[model samples]
Target: MDDPAAPRWPARATAGLCVVLLAWNTLVVPALPGRPASAVAANVAATGVLLAGARWSGLTWAELGLARRRLPAGARWGGACAALVLAAYGVALAVPALRPLLADARAGGLDGPAVAVRALVRVPLGTVLWEEVAFRGVLLAAACRLLPLRAAVALSCAVFGLWHVRPALGGLAANDLAGGPVATGAAVLLTVLWTAVAGLLFAWLRLRSGSLLAPVLLHLATNSLGVLAAAAATRGG
Candidate 1:
């Protein structure tokens, strides 16, 4: 529960920032001309901006799920989720055919050290940090105030799904999918759909653990290990 002194944000204003955050992540970031690696800097900055915006939107630390007391619970849940995902990735790598499915063209040409850096550093800081903090942290917290729990989750997750459209564009060839406008469109749509489903689970982590760190660590493991899985595929795993 929030402290009595915590300021309650107006539904309208909090909701407005939710919309802006969604659009900014989906529409604005992808359109900026730069290499994917360079986006890490921008996303790092964006994380701070989102937190500041959340506070200004009148969300308290507990509302944003960053309260220090909740960290232990969050870590347990997040760690368990991360372990499961890592095991699944291990299984996928063990299967010859499934390796192709794990291939990510973005990680295609990196050397050993480069891939290590990406999995250990880039994916965590660049992709997962801002995303969990944005969709699950600020947006979800703000949304819950204005809508039912399920509806608030749906709003955040749906947009979170669409947020991958641009990144998936570059990944189509990685899966060895057919090359055509229609095929690419379908692939992108499938990515969005699955990611939206994944978003629901991430939301559950945040709500269940009552801490943003839960989803953040889970997301970090997913994306970071994903980079390793992709590199393994590149090496004919």
Candidate 2:
């Protein structure tokens, strides 16, 4: 029999820690010198802490829908849809009329092999995992518990968009091609809109798969293709 007076300490502690970590990474690290890596590390650490909390609370990875199980059908369909969206974006950017609007869509200048290495080693196994944990696993899940599904998804997307604002604005301001306040502002606005759409799509994938792994893989694939496309554009290949 369970103890009548036993407190739900583990759950409370886990929830509290998650909040603190999110606040620290979101509000504090952006102002630091080494921003991206520090923020990413903090996010990874927060995930680890949350996992520990889950263990203490008698929750398994499977209970959190974090188990690594293959969903071949979902993977195939999601991959196709993601590729289609990316191709549409690519085609739009390639059009002469849209070139001015997509000035920020330049490639990364990485070689083909380097792009492959970065996608496999740097993005999927690193950034995607850390980002998915922070955005989908922790933030979205917590928001869903407190708010309606739509509200949670919207708020999460807003937060995700805001998180990119600093870097996007800074890059635009620093770019020689992006001149004047009007141009910079337009670039930033476009970036924000794009990120919000991507955020919503990722969230939808998470919900549809009923597992974080699917979204993580999808995110990795999308980013990898983006890098490759960027490289190709830079080389005029």
Task: Quantify all predictions' global Cα lDDT against the true fold.
Answer: 0.83, 0.62
lDDT of 1: 0.83
Q: lDDT (0-100) at residue 202 of candidate 2?
A: 82
RMSD (Å) per prediction: 2.5, 5.8
Cα displacement (angstroms), candidate 2, residue 188, comes to 1.9
**Top-scoring candidate (lDDT):** 1
- Candidate 2 segments exceeding 4 Å error: 1-46, 50-74, 82-114, 170-177
TM-scores of all candidate predictions against the true structure:
0.88, 0.67
Error of 1 at 65 (Å): 0.9
Worst 10 residues of 2 by lDDT: 1-10
For 78-151, candidate 2 gives per-residue lDDT tens digits of: 67767775876588557756444433332354556666776666565446776677666666655554556787
Candidate 1 all-Cα RMSD: 2.5
Candidate 2 RMSD computed on C-alpha atoms after optimal superposition onto the true structure = 5.8
Model 2 steric clash pairs? 107-230
* Residue pairs whose backbone atoms clash in candidate 1: none
